[model samples]
Target: MNESRVVGQVRIVGAGLLGASIGLRLRAAGVDVIVDDSSPSNLNLAIDYGAGRAARDTDDPALIVVAVPPDVTAAVVATELTAYPDALVTDVASVKVAPLAELRAAGADTLRYIGSHPLAGRERGGAISARADLFIGRPWVVTPHDDIPTAQISIIEDLVLDLGAVPVIMSAEQHDSSVALVSHVPQVVSTLLAKQLLRSTEAAISLAGQGLRDTTRIASSDPELWVQILGANSADVVPILRDFRDDLDGLLTALAAPAVPGARRAVAEVLADGNAGVARIPGKHGQDRRFSQIVVMVDDRAGELARLLTEIGGIGVNMEDLRLEHSPGAQVGLAEISVLPEVEDRLIADLEAGGWKIAGAWR
Candidate 1:
């Protein structure tokens, strides 16, 4: 079936971030959306935000998207599949294997159900934080079982494309393992690092900088939700965590005996491995392109940053990324602008000619 025909009427079972985001995007595209949530307040908030209308008995949904929490995903998917027998059902829950297993155990129609996860979300939850562009340019994994018809998989892929997300096909087990490493493990690490701050002195926090903030930012995520996610994927996550713990132990041993033979080399090897791992990540738009960064020192006063950006724009070089850093009590801010390697020389030369001080450039 075609995209529009496949997704004529979408019923979203949860009205949280993923649910509301899906509703918003579908509604914006002029598709009919019906939203329902266990929480009446959340349902109302999603409706108020123009995500979708309340469900009615007469409405026969062509598609059902389960956006509920991980703990309730299987139950909700089963319910939705039973309620809308003709509709193609899918889910946005982060974990896949457990929910699919639960559905199978519940005797739900697995043939019509496709498991999917849009690898897009904010640290914050709820409809109030929903955005239409959340899934743009992100990987949306679709896990289809052996018994599922190819046509059913196509419908789900069409829906993913409708949200401007790229679809990656994987089995349930593959999806679970991939997210365990990329998403679940990072969240656990971030939370553990943030927990250390709770016991730290105010004087230590006063000296905190961007590195600390970046590492611990996701620690602000809802703990209860994470508990459910981690529990659901614990089988896949635990082994990775054990290996990570071994690495940490090695690092601690190195730190404890910095002057011991081979200890310093071990520490250096660990750091070098991190650099290699980071470099392996895909760059802008999932391409392998790496950009050169030029750091410009700007006055802390207002309008200075805007002036710098405007000057760079006038130089006819498109900046791929920008990061701003300011030291506490300092009168200057550092703006690191990333651009194509070929444009680095011209950009730096133009910026200097336009009376902007350049700190350095790195590839």
Candidate 2:
């Protein structure tokens, strides 16, 4: 199917972050969207935010997207499949295997259903936080059953592309296992790390740095929602947790016996392994490209950062990534700009010639 052609109407079952985001993007693309939610306020908010309109009884959508909580995903999907018999159905729940299993056990129309998960979200939730570009440059995994028609799978893939997401096809088991390692385990670790701060002194928290903030940022996610997600995928998560526990035990043993023959080597190996693992993560949009970074010092005064950015634009060098860091009490901030390795030396020279203070550059 052509991507630019009209997709007709898309009915969304939930008005939360992912549903509203899909609505917003599809509406922006001139597709008719009807949004329904159990919460009246959320549906109204999504409508007011230009996501979509209220559903009508006579409306027959070509596609139905179920974005409700993981716990109720199976019920909602089953109901929608029965209600919209002609429309192809897909759900954006994080856990894939459990819901599909539930639908199979219930003897639902599994042939008309596909499972999908968009790897994009904010620390917050609800329609108010929805954006049309939420799924841009992100991977959207499509898990199609063996009995599903190829044409139906293509429709879902086209919908994913229309929402500005790259579609990656995988089986339900593979999808569940992958997210268990990458997404679920990280959330569990972050929440556990943040829990330690509950018993810390106020003075100690006041001394916390960006490292602490970065590590615990996702800990602010809704606990109830995570409880459901973690529970649904517990079978996959438990094995990963066991492996993690073993690594933690090894680290503790090394720390306790610092004087032992191989204790120092064990600690060093752990840190080195972490560095390698981080490097293995693909860059934006699963691109394997690596970038060189240049750090420029800018004053804290107004327009300084803007002036730096303007100067970089004038240099005709494209920046791949950017990070800003400010000292605790310093009047200066550091802006780290990432660019192609071949352009790093020339960019630094041009910036220096343009009177910008260069802090450092690294590959």
Highest TM-score model number: 2
Candidate 1's residue-wise lDDT over 1-363, tens digit each?
A: 124434578999999999999999888888899999999999999999999999998999989999989998999899888888899999999999999999989989999899999988999999999998899889999999968889999999989988988899999999999999999999999999999998999999988877887898888999999999999999999999999999999999999999999999999999999999888877766777788999999999989999999988988989788988887898998999999999999999998998889999999
lDDT for residue 138 in candidate 2, whole number 0-100? 92
| TM-score of each model, paired residue for residue | 0.94, 0.95
CA shift of 361, model 2, Å:
2.5
Best by lDDT: 2
Q: What is the lDDT of candidate 2?
A: 0.92
Note the Cα lDDT for every prediction shown.
0.91, 0.92
lDDT tens per residue, model 2, 1-363: 124443678999999999999999888888889999999999999999999999999999999999999999999999999998998999999999999999999999999899999988999999999999999989999999878889999999988999889999999999999999989999999999999999999889878766787799899998999999999999999999999999999999999999999999999999999988988888867888788989999999999999999888999988888888785777998899989899999999999998888999887
Against the true structure, candidate 2 reaches a TM-score of 0.95
In model 1, which runs have C-alpha deviations exceeding 4 angstroms?
1-6, 301-314, 327-330
Show how many residue pairs clash in every candidate, following the order shown: 0, 0
